[model samples]
Each structure stands twice: as C-alpha cells, then as structure tokens.
Target: MGRGLPGSISGGVKRRGLPGAAKEERIVVLETENAALHLKLAEYQGLAGRSTSEVLQLYSAHGQQQKLQRTSVVTQLHGTVKRLKQDLKRLRSFVLELSKDFQRQSKTYLYQILTAVQGIQLENEAMQMFQIKAFDLEQSLQEVTERYEKEKQKRRALHNSLVELRGNIRVHCRIRPLLPFDAASGHSISEDRQRNFPEKVAYAADDETVLIKCSRPGHASINRTFQFERVYNALESQDIVFADVAPLLTSLLDGYNVCIMAYGQTGSGKTYTMLGPQLEENFAFSIEDESELGIIPRATQEVFRLLSEKPPGSYWVEVSVVEVYNNEIFDLLAKDNYGKVFGVKREVVTTREGKSDVPLLMHETVENAAEFLHLVNKGVQLRVRHPTLVHAHSSRSHLVVTLTINTIISGDNFGTSWEDEQTSQRLNKEVSCTFPQKMRENKSTSSSRASSPTQLEATEKLKKVKTRLQLVDLAGSECVGMSGVTGAALRETSYINRSLSALADVLGAIAEQRSHVPYRNSKLTHLLQDSLGGDAKLLVMLCISPDQKYLTESMQTLGFGTRARQVQRGQLKKKNFPVPSKAK
Candidate 1:
C-alpha cells in the first residue's frame, strides 16, 4: 500500500514539482542578478575611492597655487606702501626746509626795508638843516683859518729858537735812593752830619749844583760844590727828569744829531735812567704807570707822537742796537736764540760826509712805539747781564741804540714861508749849477737875495731833511774788588775801565782844545768821534748813589762830568737838502 501511495504521490508531486522547479529557477535567476549587482558595486566602490583620492590631491594643489598668488600680491602691495611712505617722508622734510628758508629770508627782508625807510627819512631831515647852517659854517671856517695862520707863524719862530739854544752838550746829575743792601751796611759816612744827613754825604744844593762833604784826616771838612746843568735829588721822580730830556727829541725832529748818554758807578742807576728796570722782560710801553717808563721809552713815545702831529709818510724811522763788550762790537739785533751774536765784527766807518756809521749793522724799521719797544726788547734780551756783589743784575757791556729819522718836505711852503741866511746860502750853492744865480746883493747883509719869483717857487719842492738820534747806556764803572769779579770778569773790567779812560781823555782833549783829539785810542771813542767833535748835540746823564760807600766813585764821576761840560763845539745847524732849481 505504501508503494502504491508513493507512486500516486510522486505522480501528483511531479505536477506540483513542475511549478516548484520553475519557482526555484526564478529564485536562482534572482540570486544571479544579485551577485552581478554585488560585483558591479565592488568595482564601482574601488573606482569611487581612487577618484576621491585624485580629487583630494587636485584640490590641495589648487589651494597651494592660490596661496602663492595671494602671497605675491600682498608682497607687492607692501613694497608699494613702503615706497609711498618714503616719498611722504622726503616731501615732509623738503617742506620743513623750505619753510625755514622762507622764515629767514622774510626776517632779513624786513630788517633791510626798515633800515632803508629810516635812512630816507633821516636824509630828508638833514637836507633841510644843511641849507640853514651853510652861511654860519663858512664864517666859522674863515675864523679858524685866520687863527691857524697866526699860530703857524708863532710855532715856526719858537721852533727856530729852540733849535739854537738846545744845541749845547748838557750834563745832569741824579742821585738814587739808598737801597736795602746799602741800608743794611750802615756805616757813618759823616761824623758831623750823622744826626741830620746820616748817609747823605752828597747833597743837591740847587737845580744846578751839588755839595759833597768828605771827612779828611788832617784837613777840615773837605767841602766841594760841583756845578752841573741840572741836579735831581733822590726824591725826584723819573717823569721830572724826562721833562728836561723831552725837548732834545724835538730838536732831533728839527734835523739835528742828538746823543744822550748815561754814565755812573756800579750799582748806581745808569740802566734805570736809560732803560727802566727789567723793562725788556715786560716788552710793553703801556706800563701800568706811564711815569715808570725810562728815557728810551719816553723818547720813543714822544717821537711817535710828534710824527703823528705831522703828515703821515713824511718821515721814516729806523732803529739799530749794538753792544760793546770787552772792546768788541756786537750787533745785539743780529743774534740767534742761543744768545750768540751772528756775523763778523762790525767796523765803525766814517763816511765821506764825515758821518760815523757801523757797517752791516741791522736796522729795523718800526712804525709805532709798540713795535719799537718790541724791537728794543728783543735787542735787550740778547744783551749780556751778570749778577755781581755790587748789583744783582749788572749790564756787562755798553748798549747803544740809534734812531735814524728821514723826513721829506714837499715844498718850502711846509710850515715856513721865509728863508733864513743858512737856507739862502745852501740854496744859492745848489742853484748855481743848474740856474743862473747871483750872490746876495750885499755880503754884510744876512737877508737872502731875491731871485726870480718863479725860480724860487720852482726850487722849493726839492728839500729833504735827515737826522740821527743816539741813546747810549754806558756800562757802570765798577771796582774789581767790590764787584767780586775774577778771571774773565776781571779782564772785562779792565777793558771797560780802559775804554772809559779813553772817553775821559777824549773829553779832556776837547776841553783843552787840542789840535788832534785822541779819538782813535779806543773803539768807544772812535765810534763817538762824530758826536764828540762836530755840531752833534750831546747829553750826559750822571747817575749816582746816595750810599756812603760810593763817595769816591761818585766824586770821580762828578769830576768827569765837569770836564765833559767844558767841551765846546760849533753851533748846530739843521741838516736839510739844498733847494734844486730847474735843470737847464
């Protein structure tokens, strides 16, 4: 039964299996389609992942390029901004400088405009006043001219008289105050006058006399009165002494040779009188006290002042300084820094015109007193000085300063309208060669012969005047023992004494009126031959000390001065060029 049932079921199942098989086939097809879709989805998923990676890489590169471009643009903008800021700074600096320049220019223009306006207003006012005062000014000028003419005549006459009377060789005596060293050694010089004049052995009697009293062993008080041209007491100041010397400088300007010399014993005041104490160290004429200036400085100042009183360029002043040490001539101006004098020994030569001059001597041209003082100071610095027991600073040589003055006068109408007898003689001699000139109408008459007015006027322009001034500071005479000198100093002392003795001998010969004066005995005398013999005006300043120890030396100096005063020379005449007439 089971087999029959299985077959029937199988037959029925076949009918149902056909449908079931078709259902299975449909299910398999559906599974196959699903598998194919899965495969395609896997392929699509791999492609999508690779494409996503590539897209991500391309987006990163694009972002990098955009960043680079933006960076470049920003850098350019920054550079442009920086250049603009620099240009702005330059423009601001230029504007500031232009503003400053404009401010300065405006201030200057304002000042100039104000000044011009004020000047124009003042000129208009001055023009109105000028016309009103013209007549009064003319009258005043006429009155001044008349007064000037009268004063001119008087000045000319006074100048002539001074020239005549001031020609004598005068001797003056000056006594210095007692020094500290001299006071320390207080010895009774006079037993009688110890109470009143303890150290005053020599006393000034008057303006021209000095009384000296000395105690002798046997004889009663030896009283002697020495007469000089002038005597100054110890209390007298330097200015008072220079008052007597100032007129000599004026005589020099009038064309006369003037020589002023100082002579004294050692430790007296020779250098102080000639040149102030240590003035070379100061090197200035503008001293705190003008009265302290010595004769040389005073004379130089007066010379410059007088030169300024006249026209400029009318005179030329030249100065030279020389020193004589141990009978040797040395140019103090010609020296090196080491105090060694340069060049060969200068010889005093007498020119054909009978004038004495040292050849090759250095002459420095000086304009004012300051320049002259500087030059003189330079020469003084080169001078030899030695400290001695008698004087702390003693000049070891004779210093001579010479001033040569050359003057040019345009015409005879310069200050003087009339001609004197000497002028007429000089003019006549000069004009005789060039123009036909006759002698004076009368030989006895001092009046000049009147030449043709035209010829007289023509010759007036050829006048020139020259004069020489010498300032000599002689070495102080010293006693060898008192000066505490030996060796080379002793030899120098001997030469100095010898030269002084020769000078005294020359003066003695002149006083005795000898035919041949012993001027060639020493270089000093030989150099002073012109000043001693001719019409050269000479002045001797005898400086003495009030110290009792120098009584003997002072007496000797007085005696020497007395002998010098006896020397007589010809009348001094002004040196001037002869008027030249028109050449034929």
Candidate 2:
C-alpha cells in the first residue's frame, strides 16, 4: 500500500512538473518573439538613418551648386564694377579737359572785348575833353575883353597875405559799461573790494568772465580792475564791438579795405575781447543773433548777408587768416607735420600804381559761425603759447586774420531800356568813329595787334576786378616788471616793447604830419602803415584798467589814445589802384 501511494504521488509530481515546464517553454517563446521584434526594429531604424543620410547628402550637393552660382554672379559683378571704374576715370579726364578749354576760351573772348572797349573809350574820352576845352576857350574869348579892364583894377587893390592852416576831426567812441549779469540783484561790490576779496569769493560779472578768471588764477585780481574798459564778459562786450564796427563793415561791402585791430597790454583782456574768453558755454553763441555774435563770426555773417543782397555774379569774397610770430609771418592755413612750425615767405609785388605787400594766400571758405570758429580754433591750437607768471596760458605772439574781398562788375548792361539803348548807340558810334572802317577792314593789322603779347597781357589785366579787406589783431604790449616775465619771455617782452615803441613813434609822426614817417622801423608799424596813416578807416580801442593800481599805466594809455586821436589821414576816399595781372 505504501509503494502504490508513492507511485501515485510521484505521478502527481510529474504532472505538476510537466505543466511548470510548459509554462517555462511559453515564457521562452515570448522572450524569443520579443528578441525578434527588437532585431526588426533595429534593422528598420538602420534603413531610416541611411535614407536620412542620403537626403542630407543631396541637400549638401544642392547647397554647393547654389554657392557656385552665387560665386559666378559675384565674379561677373566685380568685372562690371572694374569696367565702370575705368569709365569713370575716362569721364573725369574728359570733364577736366572741358573745363580747361572753357576757361581758355572765356579768357580769350574777355581779352578781345576788353581791348576793343578800352581803346574806343579812351579815344571817345579824349575827343569829349577836346570839344569841351574848345567850347570853353570860345566862351572865355568872348568874355575876356569885357573882364580884362575890370580885372586889372581889382588886382591892383588886392592885399598880399599868405595864410596856411591845418586841422583834423577826431572821432572817439567811449563804449559804456555793459549791464552786469547780476544787475537784477543790484548787490555788486566796488572794484577795490572785489580785488581784495578771497580768490574763490571773487565775483565775476558773467560766465565768460568767470572762465577767464579761473583760467588764470593769478591774473584774476588784475583782470577785475580792467572790467570797465574792456569787459571780460564775452556775452556783453563782443556784441557791442560788433555793433560799434557795423558801419565800417558796411563800407567794406562797397569795395573798401577795412581793418579792425585790438591793442592793449598783456592780461588786459586782448584775447578775451578779440577771441572771447575760453569757455565751452561761449560756443552756444549763434551768428544769426546779434546778442551772441563774436567779432570774426559777426564779420563773416555781415559779409555773407551783404553778399546775398547784392546782384548775383557781381561780387565774390575770399577769406584768409595769418599769424605774425616774432615779427615773422606765418600762414595759419598752411599744412605741415603735426607739431612742426611751418612759415610762408611774404612777397613784395610791384604793380603799375606802386609797390604792394602781398601775403601768401591761405584761402578759406566760411559759411557759418561754427565753421569760422573751427578754423579759428585750429589756428589757435597751432598758435604759439607759453605759461607765464601773469597768465597761465599767454599768447606768445600776435595773430592777424585777413579777409580778402574781390568784386567784379560785369559790363553786361543791366540798366533800363533808355540807358542801355543810349549806351549801346554811343558805344557803337564811338567804336566806328575811333577805329574807322579802314582799321577794321585790315584783318592782318588787327590780328597783329591782338596777338601782341604785351597788348594781350594788358588787356587781360583790365578785365577783372579785385579788392582787399583786412582785420588785424595786434599782440598786447606788455611791461616786463608787470608781466613778471623771464628768460624767453624777457626776449619776447623786449621785442614787443620795441615794436610798440616804434608804433607809438609812428603815431606821433602821423600826428605831427611828418612827410617822412619812419614806418619801416618795426615790422608791426610797417604792416599797419596803410591802415594807420593810409586811406583805411581806423578804430583804435584804448583798453584801460580802472583800478588805482593801474592808474599810472592807465594814464599812459589814455595819453596814447589822445595822441592817436590827434593823427589824421585827411578826408581819404577809396582808391582802386590798378593791379598788374601777373602780380598774383
């Protein structure tokens, strides 16, 4: 019975084992299916990756083809640009040739017309003078007999007395003190008290005055004294000077040479008055407004304003700025090494009228105040400067800026019909009568005369018109002891004093009406000879300090002013001297 039970239990165990084995086999088959799926998925993924790579390669090949096409287009464009550049070069050459040809033809026509007109005009004038003289003689002969008997008796009764007289009318301008910046407060201190005040506590009248005071700490005390004569307040004084000189400037537009100069002692606001006190705020001043206009800027504005009012092509204005350093002339507009000093030689050209002093041309065009200031600032940078006990940034030399005005009157008749017709008829009749048909008919004779080098040159000379206007700023005359100058400054001081003394001598001689005034004694006097004693309308600004400390110097300055006032060049009129064409 135990054996039979064991066999049945074993069979039962076998049966359980068989089901477990079948479950394991099913698990294995599922596992095998999972592996097969994974392998198929891997194979599919590999094929997809290959397809993507092929597509990427095709895209890359397309990009390369596009790049090649773009390169070809760029190359063609470069070639076209090169050809266009060549064409532009040719066009420039052609334009230059055309300009040269136009200039030459214009000059030739001008010369021919001028020669014919001048000759006829001269002959007509001579004939008119002759006829007038002949008529006057005829009238005189008729009256001679009647007056001869009465004149004899009157001459016998006349008493013999010789009287010679000379006199001059001196025009002086006493510019009133400008309104104080703080006039609203009315708490201004006396000049004496202001001088004694502490450095920082010292009150300045305006922004520019404050900048000037700060620029040279030591000179502030002395500068405060001169407030009455020449105010450091650029906001006030510069505009006033422009107003004062407006009349003289107006005459400049009428073909007259005008010179405006600033003369004073060192540290006496010469630079401040002429160039304005150095301050960034001063640039805010505009040329359009008189309240903000400076000397140079205002002058340029006035000139252009007048130019605009004049008939077009009737006038042209050119500007040049030059500096005189150590009695030597230097062209401020010249180009040179960044820091090197470049100078130009002055040439004395002899003209038909007389010997003329012609400075080297440094032509510049100034359209506005800002442009003018830029050129002036560039010039200021190039100007010689040094530190001194009196002024931290003292001007080492004098600077002069000249504006040359050239005006041409086109002989083209712009007058009314009556005047034009009259002139035309008169000109035609005069031309025919003076030349005679015989002369006109002889082509060889006319050609020979026209082709003559001297005649052609003279004819060319008379065709154009030119005028000059000069604005000069003289260096301040300084005393060594007052300036506390030494070494190089001492030498400069000596040159300055000597030149100023020479200037004083020239003024004295002019006052005395000496026939032989020594103008060549110094370069300053020589350069200013025409403006001082010649036809130029001169305005001498006698800068003085009101402080008691400068009383003696102020007195001397006033005395100089008095002497300057005594000098006169008579009732001088503008003289348009004939210039040789080749002089330039």
Question: Lowest-scoring 10 consecutive residues by lDDT in candidate 1?
Answer: 439-448
Candidate 2 lDDT score relative to the true structure = 0.54
Off by over 4 Å in 2: 1-236, 279-292, 337-352, 365-373, 411-463, 575-584
Model 1 scores a TM of 0.59
lDDT of candidate 2 at residue 137, scale 0 to 100: 91
Clashing pairs in 1: none
lDDT (10s digit) by residue, model 2, range 1-584 = 32354446546656777676765665556556666777898899999999899999999999999999999999999999999999999999999999999999999999999998999999999999999999899889878956974674354223100000122222222222322221221123334323432222123353112211233334433332222222233234566666656756666654446766666655555565556545433322233444544466677667666556543333334455566666665666665567443545453232455434554445555444455566666666666666554455667777767665544332453222322445446444433433323334421111111235644453342223445566665666765655567788788777777777788898888888888887777766766666666556665665444333333444455566667756665654464432212221
- The 0-to-1 C-alpha lDDT of every candidate, in the order given, reads 0.73, 0.54
Model 2 residue 550 distance off true place after TM-score fit, in angstroms:
2.4
